[model samples]
Target: MTAITINFNNVLKLSDDQFYQLCRDNPDVKFERNAFGELIIMSPTGGETGKCNASMTADFIIWNRQTKLGEVFDSSTCFKLPNGSDRSPDVSWIKLERWNALTSKQREKFPPIAPDFVLELMSPSDSLSETQAKMQEYMNAGVKLGWLIDRKTRRVEIYRQGQQKEVLESPTSLSGKDILPGFVLDLLFV
Candidate 1:
């Protein structure tokens, strides 16, 4: 199923704490909030998508471990963006310095910073338009690099700050470029 969005602005608006509590209260649900205060309920990925996500996340973790330049986070970790939106990418990374700047309490809850890099792997249930919009949101929130990968179409859209997006078709791999020097994502698994 595709994601379902609900607008509660007319009835009640959830504060940051309340949104956290809502997520905590519903452990089984994957939730996201738009800058307009609409709640998005996302469906869980299928087996193939899950496996691909795990592999991609593992690659990021291994790369981060070797470089020690950033912290890698899986899909479950959400960040509060500058535009009042709360989003969780399939995989995300924050530079070491940026991550270290967060206070303990801030780190304990949703991180109040945009990830330096983000990757979104499309699942059967995902809408391309919606996912692209989300990527734009990330860029607007100061994400330096982002990737939208569609395995079905063997397409990759690369987003960089202050530059036009580049689309690659059936590429064998992806480069991390300046943002993640020496890091390359092998698309074979996808």
Candidate 2:
């Protein structure tokens, strides 16, 4: 169930509008774009992964609701990154001020900014190397904090801006640290 990647570096490159239209026309296939304009097609995750994704998304949503700090986005929300890639993290959040900077139309379409925080949960179909690369891309695109959670391994890779990635094994919880003050992720279920 590994995701397929189509290299478009030599092929005809899709324009931003064309890519948007392609996504809109094909609602069933999940697609992503790399900085090199390569197309990534991913299949739907299995039930276990779906449940885990939902629970983690709910955690971020609840925190955002309580703090009113920023906008929270689920996996379906794609972002046009500064590097020209289109990515969708499992759970993402942006600072209120930064989000406010975008106009209504910008908000209506795929957001044109990287999130302040991003989270990715590994599914059975996902490859660890590919996921790690994606997390690195997030950091390079201005994500302040990112987490790569592998439920099967019960481990988490913490990625922070201008810092080395830290791997934690079998942790029961994760702190938001300075990036997400007063927030913590209970990973008991994950």
**Model 1 regions lying over 4 Å from their true place:** none
User: Which prediction has the highest TM-score against the true structure?
Assistant: 1
lDDT of 2: 0.93
Question: Which ten-residue region of model 2 has the weakest summed lDDT?
Answer: 8-17
List runs of model 2 lying over 4 Å from the truth.
none
How do the predictions measure up, each by TM-score? 0.99, 0.97
lDDT of each: 0.97, 0.93
- How many clashes does the backbone of model 1 have? 0
lDDT of 2 at 85: 97
Q: Write the per-residue lDDT of candidate 2 for residues 71-165, one digit (tens) a residue.
A: 89999999999999999999999999999999999998888999999999999999999999999999999999999999999999999999999
Candidate 1 — worst ten consecutive residues by lDDT sum? 181-190
Kindly report the root-mean-square deviation of model 1 from the true structure over all alpha carbons: 0.6
